[model samples]
Target: MREAFDHMYISCWEWSISVLEEVGATKPLYPPTMLRFTKRDTNSATPGPYSYPAMTLDECQLADFSEFETFDNYCYAMFTFYQLIQQTSGLSGEVNLEVRSPRFLETVASKDDIFLIEGMHCVKFKNDRFEEKVMAHWRREMPVRTFRRKDRA
Candidate 1:
């Protein structure tokens, strides 16, 4: 489960970086020079090292979710995971995607975070077995799967 999550998170960065490169982003943007990881608190943690990609809006060079069909779904899953943690474990932090790119924001119609959930519904997983396994783990870990997204609309 953790492995799949790590792969998907890395894929998001790689995909976004490639798109930035195609559009002639500067040298520092081509190959990521710095990568940041947050260590989980051992006293109250899940199994394994469990570090996900962490970045701030200031660090974002591009917010391109174009052409990639699974991109929104990945974002939706990530947001959902954080929400689940907060609800199930009483964690405090919030997940907010404050997209700085006005051009990218223009492409998306919905102002609400529900757009991710809705967009995810439009795409299907290619690998059935992998999807099933992941979903099963999700079900076990997170009993409450659906929640209302904060409406910015």
Candidate 2:
């Protein structure tokens, strides 16, 4: 599973690079402008490490997903490529993709402490299973006076 995760991450990076090249966009010095990693504790930590890939808005449309058939083919190609890489690498983990704001830095200091931007969704792949979840946290702000009732005094 770890191998799959790593392969997915690497593939994502390569794909991003390819997209930039195809679109004639200036590639950043770093493949990923921002990176976030889950936290670990000494007391209960796993032996292997985990990571994922993230891309900016400018990077997303480079593939020209405007062509549905071509885009679908691209996705299949990515899936097959990663599967082969995982088989050869002997790493066992999952591949997960999440749509997030390019300004992720302003909200999330790290993967474990993510603050979801208004319009992002998380897609996760684990143990050959895929799932999608909304990243937004829904909450209502309460009036301050409600907590400080006059009768309480």
Candidate 3:
């Protein structure tokens, strides 16, 4: 299951990078990022000692993640990250009002996971002009999984 989750997570990240590239906004958008792969045995009977290695993406190869998968999970991840960037940079109002190709609608229907589903809803609001009724519906819906960072300290 660890490997499957890792594959899913990495695939999601790759999808994000690909969408960013399609928009011709990779350099200005993707910050230096890292992925730390970890595995722990949930069964108490088996482990004597175990430590998982954290891997950092080399500067030159960070863009390679863009090829992880062809699924819509990538586009949703990009939208989520873009929102994060806007919030962090305090430039939410400065984002372009124009919608671009590979629009959220094009990719949303293909998503299989709840995280990506909620992500699509959020992206819809962020990218297009929606009715107040529609916006309220999505806002009321809860996401399946909230992103969390492992405690490293």
All candidates' lDDT scores? 0.34, 0.32, 0.33
lDDT of 3 by residue, 72-129 (tens): 3333454455454445335433322233323443444235232222233232233442
- Runs with alpha carbons beyond 4 Å of true place in candidate 1: 1-9, 28-95, 99-104, 111-153
Q: Candidate 3: global Cα-lDDT?
A: 0.33
What order do candidates take by lDDT, descending? 1, 3, 2
How do the residues 99-138 of candidate 1 rate in per-residue lDDT, one tens digit apiece?
Answer: 2233333344243343332132121122344344444555
User: How does model 3 score by TM-score?
Assistant: 0.25
Model 2 lDDT tens row, 57-136: 55654544343334233333334434443544345332222423344333331241222222243222232221111111
Residue pairs in collision within model 1: none
When 1 and 2 are scored with TM-score, the better candidate is 2
**Model 2 steric clash pairs:** 1-92, 1-93, 2-92, 2-93, 3-91, 3-92
